[model samples]
Target: MDTEKYVPGISVDSNGHPSEIGIEITPEAFKNLETDNSKTVPPDGETIVVPLQLKATELTPFDHIGLNWNPHGHEPAGVFDVPHFDIHFYMISAEEQLAIPAWSPETDAAFNNYPPIGYMPADYFTPPGPATAEPQMGKHWLPGNLGAYLPFSKIMIYGSYNGKFIFVEPMITLDYLLSDVDFSANYSQPEHFEKAGNYPTKYNIYHDAVSGNTYVTLSDFVARN
Candidate 1:
């Protein structure tokens, strides 16, 4: 697939600070996705990782974005086992992200190293069990009682490693993206930020009729320390 069709962009405020960052997906690009699960190695699943460079200096703290496509979803089964996308707005560099070791006895401490109390959002917590941390990604924190009972569709996630927040994520199902309705929702915010910068307080998913494109956007930036 021509990954270039998936464009990553940023919108800035009057003060020259980044107000929004998003990815634009053309209608044709969505239809031509890979769906074979067996082809991918274990742990990673049938996933495609697309790295995004927004070329905006105002987007400090956040180095780039990682657009991950899970064709058959992932683990902690029955909850996120369907097709979906994990969009990671990473504050760390791609090199640092890739340097994360695979989950194992030797790397248990690293994967399980979570952020401090006030750094995490009030409502978000790690899924119960033997560390749901992913290699090269870090631990995922979800909001509310999301389990086998609640049907998976779309949700916001926060990621951290070694007591520092690294990424802001929006996990959306393939079904939801294919639908016609536009979506906008407020995501939870941490009591305090680990790094001083502009952070998105809200996220949105909308379809452009004229351009025939889909946009998953993060906006409503607020400066924090």
Candidate 2:
């Protein structure tokens, strides 16, 4: 059916309407993981633990706006730690964030080998825990697919102080996403990022919408104004 919902991971119109993409990814290529699929995209469910230590990197354009702009919403910027240099990305729920301790350089190297903070294979997905007791979830152990949304609404990154500077490659899906996820809801005309606050007007020329979630190199952002 034809509709005008905002799909996260997809770009949006100036009015926040979701733009259509040219390609499609069916179940053949993209797995529709139930709480119990062999691939276990999110093995547990609501909680997928990132294996790393992190320090707070400046909250990009969003930080400039206000971390709690939503009054009570997820922070778009992930935390980073200078000691360990690990990054924690995609932390949408507060529960997930509270699960781990602040980043520590000493733990960065061996934390992966310990339980409660062990690393799972990208394919070894698990929700926060085996199940959630939240009334919203009913009696299922998996997350309540209450709406047509993914497990997490935002993405974040946290890394130890010295592990590496390689950013987590963005994991984008050709599938649909929620409206709030598609656009920088907190961003307005002047507040939007100017590709690191520098560049020419033409370099900032953006399409009505974009094609992916990962950051595209803004060679244009560096152009002289």
Candidate 3:
């Protein structure tokens, strides 16, 4: 879309590893994120990522932010710091088939057996601050809503080789792909997350095709109860 390439699986080097978010989602990079099945691609290539997470100190330093799937600015990247609640992502591209309703609790509508992603419900409540009274990190899995995790959420992906969602090379890392959506690993304690205990969120996931990729950095992001 933006002329491709936005790698960031920790921007490794000097021995840390990862130089390009673990590249290798071939099949021409999942047929270049698709538009019309790119000729029924699948000599290998198919992915569906967006499995929420965050809590590596909530992230800071920025090449990109707000979605923790990293890589949004084309680079050997790494940055974070920004996320106090106000995340965004809705690229449901099966060439676009998301009317999501029939009892829209946030989906489980099953046109594709969903949940390759997480924490949605308008990202835990819409426009205002502290979205519906702060304290989030998980919830909403079946007509959802139980104080739905809090906010400080997560969801991004990097899968192909037939996994399911190839929305174009989206392997996450580097503070979950460029942190900082106003950030907060407790930014002045927004009630220090009221309910769902054990709060410590982190997320870095990537699983590619042509055979190359791996990273699931989420030590934890609790507060679920």
Candidate 4:
């Protein structure tokens, strides 16, 4: 997968703090996506890790970005079984993310150790059971009152590990990415932060007709104590 085709970048304020972070997906990159699930990681997915530019790494808490392509989304059956991409802006290093253990009886304690009450977004909740925690990734927190019967398209997700916020994710379906419409929305914020840094309050997805590229950006950063 031509890693260079997917560029991760950041915009900073006058003081050098990150104001926006995003990924630029070239037209060829999206058009040539691997749709065969057999070629992906076990279950049905392919993950491409892109290191943030040096400037971005120095200014923001995130170290890298992970683009996971799901040909046939895993688990929860009807809810997320469609083809989509899970964009993860990871605060942890690539090595640390890889060391995360898969869910099992032995690793139950590690995965179940939920973050303190104000650490996660106000309305997000970790689904019950050990299956909620994924290997090489972490546990996913979904909106408390999501309409289960509705079709899955796009949504912002929060990821945590061992009681700490590790990554911010935006899940977008393949069909949506192919559409002409653009999307921008404010995501819910947590009452407290474990790490002090500028955090994004909104996300955007748009297609540039001239460049024939798709941009997924996180903006409106607000400093937190």
Candidate 5:
């Protein structure tokens, strides 16, 4: 019997419509985890413990945002230390983010060891450049899905690397359609961000409802004028 196929699940739409999708889990994958874990798992199915010493030396982006915005104002930026933050990314499909393959020792050995790609220091964010200029950064994690009208709406599990979990939550609302120029200007000025008196401390993830593709950015909050 094929263990991967499960009953279809329903995802509700904004207008109260329900759509069916197969949210599946292979029985053996979890049952035999120790023998067939992916590259992400360390030897004992335990994550490698990054040292507390490193936390004293470097403050992650989430650390900075929380320190600056935390309700109690208890922690100073770059002062208190943490191991990880719960960061979620919106993805177009489960395969796009993590493609599970046929279990094999060979494939397990090839798990990617690339340091989390697309990280930029707080100092690199500048006045937005021309509309045609290359974006300031690359793929990254965020505090949440961070956009509206996300067609896929599937949230990827949180991830951490090198003792850092970046986070940026735009205060912008998604009530209106976004134009190319308007989108660019939002990145340039980011009124909501300015009003909040915080820098774009993390990044954003957006899904193209039409094309069904997912994208990441440090700017472009789909908010009001």
Candidate 6:
């Protein structure tokens, strides 16, 4: 967790271009911040580092931030910060799974579903600043809030390999990914999403097993009127 000893590794820019400077991280270090919930443990070897890019105007820099996907407009909780636009890739090997005591022939199917490499966007929202508010009466009703504080994107690859999350140094920018797109695009519009046959509840990146590629889709995170 001490980034002081971390070194730079191979990384890619937001456009998927290769770069030489990436922040290297170990599984032990990653576990300090994230858990192996999917249980896709990595093997013992040279740990790979993930790269992140910061906004030019951002005064402070952070390797990672918790994303607050508050689709229902409830009270916010935990430390959340806007994510950096770019993410880096990390790879896993089959030997690591073999090293685990729980390794079994039946587990091969699970491992096959995971990609050998993955990339998670650095973007997230910063904790809200303190603000006073008046209490509402029991009979008062409020309309749904449908705006994103910041652009959110994250990708978890399946293994063809996985580990703890490694949030590292800057590499690419978000603008590079959506290059040439009209600035008028509105992803936060609930009505617009419905017209397009999409739900505006919760948007996320999904991986296609047949195509070996990732795509984004909008679905309900809560009941929508």
Question: When superposed on Cα atoms, how far off is each prediction in RMSD?
Answer: 2.7, 16.8, 15.0, 1.9, 19.3, 20.8
* Per-residue lDDT over 1-225 for candidate 1, one digit per residue giving the tens place of the 0 to 100 score: 346767788887787877778878888767766677654332334223456555453565667667777878887688888888888888888888878766777777766777878898988888532466887788888886566225988888889876688988888888899895798888889999867888889999999999989898898888897
Expressed as tens digits, the lDDT of each residue in 88-183 for candidate 2 is 132223342334343345433322321222221122221332121111111111113323223433322221111111111112222222121333
Q: In candidate 5, where is summed lDDT lowest over 10 consecutive residues?
A: 65-74
Residue 110, model 2: Cα distance from true site in angstroms: 7.4
Q: Which candidate, 4 or 6, would have the higher TM-score against the true structure?
A: 4
Stretches of candidate 3 exceeding 4 Å from the true structure:
1-32, 36-125, 128-200, 205-211, 214-217, 221-225
- List where candidate 1 sits over 4 angstroms from the true fold: 39-57, 127-130, 147-149
Cα TM-score of candidate 5: 0.18
lDDT of 3 at 195: 29
Ranking by lDDT: 4, 1, 3, 6, 5, 2
- Candidate 6 ranges beyond 4 A from true positions: 10-20, 34-225
What is candidate 6's lDDT per residue for 66-122, written digit by digit as tens?
Answer: 111111122222211221222222121223322332223454333223211222222
Q: lDDT (CA) for every model shown?
A: 0.77, 0.22, 0.25, 0.83, 0.24, 0.24
| lDDT comparing candidate 5 with the true structure | 0.24
Instruction: Please identify model 4 stretches exceeding 4 Å from their true place.
Output: 40-43
Collision count of model 6: 21
What digit string (tens of lDDT, one per residue) describes model 5 on residues 87-183?
A: 2221112222233232244433222221233332322231211211111111233223223323312212222222222223232211211211122
With a 3 Å backbone cut-off (N, CA, C), the pairs that clash in candidate 1 are none
Stretches off by above 4 angstroms in model 2 are 1-27, 37-152, 158-163, 169-225
Best by lDDT: 4
1 or 5, which is superior by TM-score?
A: 1
TM-score of each: 0.89, 0.23, 0.23, 0.93, 0.18, 0.18
* Candidates 1 and 4, the one with greater lDDT: 4
True-structure RMSD for candidate 3: 15.0
Error of 4 at 64 (Å): 0.7
